[model samples]
Target: MCDILVPLTANAQRIGTEEERKLLDQSIQLCQRLLIEVTLSEATKLVGRAEYEDALPGSIQALRFSLEIYGSGRSELIPCYILLAEANLGLSRFKQAEECLCNANWILIKTRDNDKKVKSILYRGFGRLYAAQGKREEALRQLANDVSPNAALTDTVC
Candidate 1:
């Protein structure tokens, strides 16, 4: 499953009331439980309402747990790296995000998933990192690549 951090962050931004905050906390806890013992759509659902920085540690832990359960050879690795990169980006940890993105890109390239949706994620991650570094051109390039109509080409590297 993919972790769409931007949407998650946007949803989390709606947390203003104490009741909403409590619900978010409960969702986070449920996500942790699901990640710890079982794979559940509930966990993915919870992710959409999670604050990135706040969810970073748990997301990383969830990925590790998934890797452990599914074995290192499984295909869950790419999304794990993507989640980590997005979390790091949310925390303004550009270097960590870049490193994670590098790993994610490597996985994607190796897997040869010709899916632009996955490629777009990698590009979006890079765009965030470049934007943080004040590299406007690089950021724009990455963002453009993310939304490019024909990102199926090999040169469409993030």
Candidate 2:
């Protein structure tokens, strides 16, 4: 089930013909009903294993599916963005990672979401991204933000 749904959902995002859009809509519906959690979990595990290349498609699929379900700039999409950032960071794709983190930050700002755990994840991702880029001071600042009790309220990553 996951094997089939994963590619279907991921590829549907590309070929944007009218027929593909219809297929994408159907795929999104199926993903929401059944495969979202499974796909995300697999993607997370792949990232945990440092298999960034393998994880990208699943992370992307999860992000698109979340977008379909929650709309843009919703807090619900934060985790998917974070996961993508993590994968990109692992792969040394710094620009892509930064973009993903920026997207998450924008969503946080737009939604005014105050979930500390989510903010922690976002800051941690930024910390790692900066660290990977050899920006020591920025890395430390982001890591500090990740741990600071009031960081969620004080920091805006965008």
Candidate 3:
């Protein structure tokens, strides 16, 4: 018999039924086992908003917890890095943010779905990091790569 332990978060604690609980438990088990692919995009917007509102520690914890459970291979995980990198950027941890952006870029490169969009996000993130580091040329290169703008892209700093 394979015994699996899936750590549940506060968000996973509010289901109102046994069946839902069972399903969530199973899903958590699969996540811990790395048998299910969890995408970072599913939760990033909420987390990012939380960060923007100065609720970053919790948001970062949620993302980091998810990353630990999901094993970080999915394309959706790219946004997790990006969001966390942004948080780090806020903290003036530029090197850490740069590393996170690099990882996001690698994930974007390997992703098959919405490559253009993913590349654009990665480019924008890199641009932000480069801008922070005073590398204007590098920042411009990345900004130029971001041609197809999404409605979500409001801040030009990124």
Candidate 4:
């Protein structure tokens, strides 16, 4: 992927015709999306392997690229935020995890996104965060919402 992106990025820095510039811009965007996906996959693998320290930087990079590509309020950011929250939770950084979850919740609210799968992931992240903090009741509530069909339409945020 870097092989493709490196040349495109270098070419992007040079002056070009209007049509060429548009094509270059499109190619860059596509490459960025690929990079984001690959980074997220690697970070997720690291998190799964309980390598939170290793995952943190990649998660942050994915989040940064996602924010740049999709903007702050888009639903696309939810997964990035959730991954970051999960990594932070794994590292026992409760405050940072909560902040990331809250940012994701804010994006969901701002965008009015009602995707059940997305909400489930967000809820699960919160549930894990609360559990890590020893907030059993809060964790259970979030976990319940994660599995409850009716909870998908509700405006629940941590």
Q: Using lDDT, give the best candidate's number.
A: 4
After superposing candidate 4, which stretches have Cα over 4 Å from the reference? 1-14
Deviating ranges (above 4 Å) for candidate 2: 2-30
Worst lDDT run of 10 residues, candidate 3, spans 34-43
Pairwise TM-score winner, candidates 3 and 4: 4
Q: 104-146, model 3: which lDDT tens digit per residue?
A: 7666555544566666677777788889889999788678767
Q: Select the stronger candidate by lDDT from 1 and 4.
A: 4
RMSD of each: 13.0, 5.3, 9.1, 2.5
lDDT of 4 by residue, 1-158 (tens): 55764664464364689998888677777877888898899999999999999998878877877877888788888878888988988889999989999998988888887777778888888888888888999889999989887886566565
Write down the lDDT that model 2 would get: 0.83
Q: TM-score for all predictions?
A: 0.64, 0.80, 0.59, 0.86
User: How much lDDT does each candidate structure score?
Assistant: 0.67, 0.83, 0.61, 0.83
lDDT of 1 by residue, 2-93 (tens): 36333333435545699988887666555544664333233333445655655566557667666655656445676777777776777788
The per-residue C-alpha lDDT of model 3 at residue 131 equals 92
lDDT of 2 by residue, 55-97 (tens): 9987887887788877898887888888899999999999999
What candidate 1 gets wrong by more than 4 Å, as runs, is 1-50, 154-158
Residue 8 of model 2, lDDT score:
55
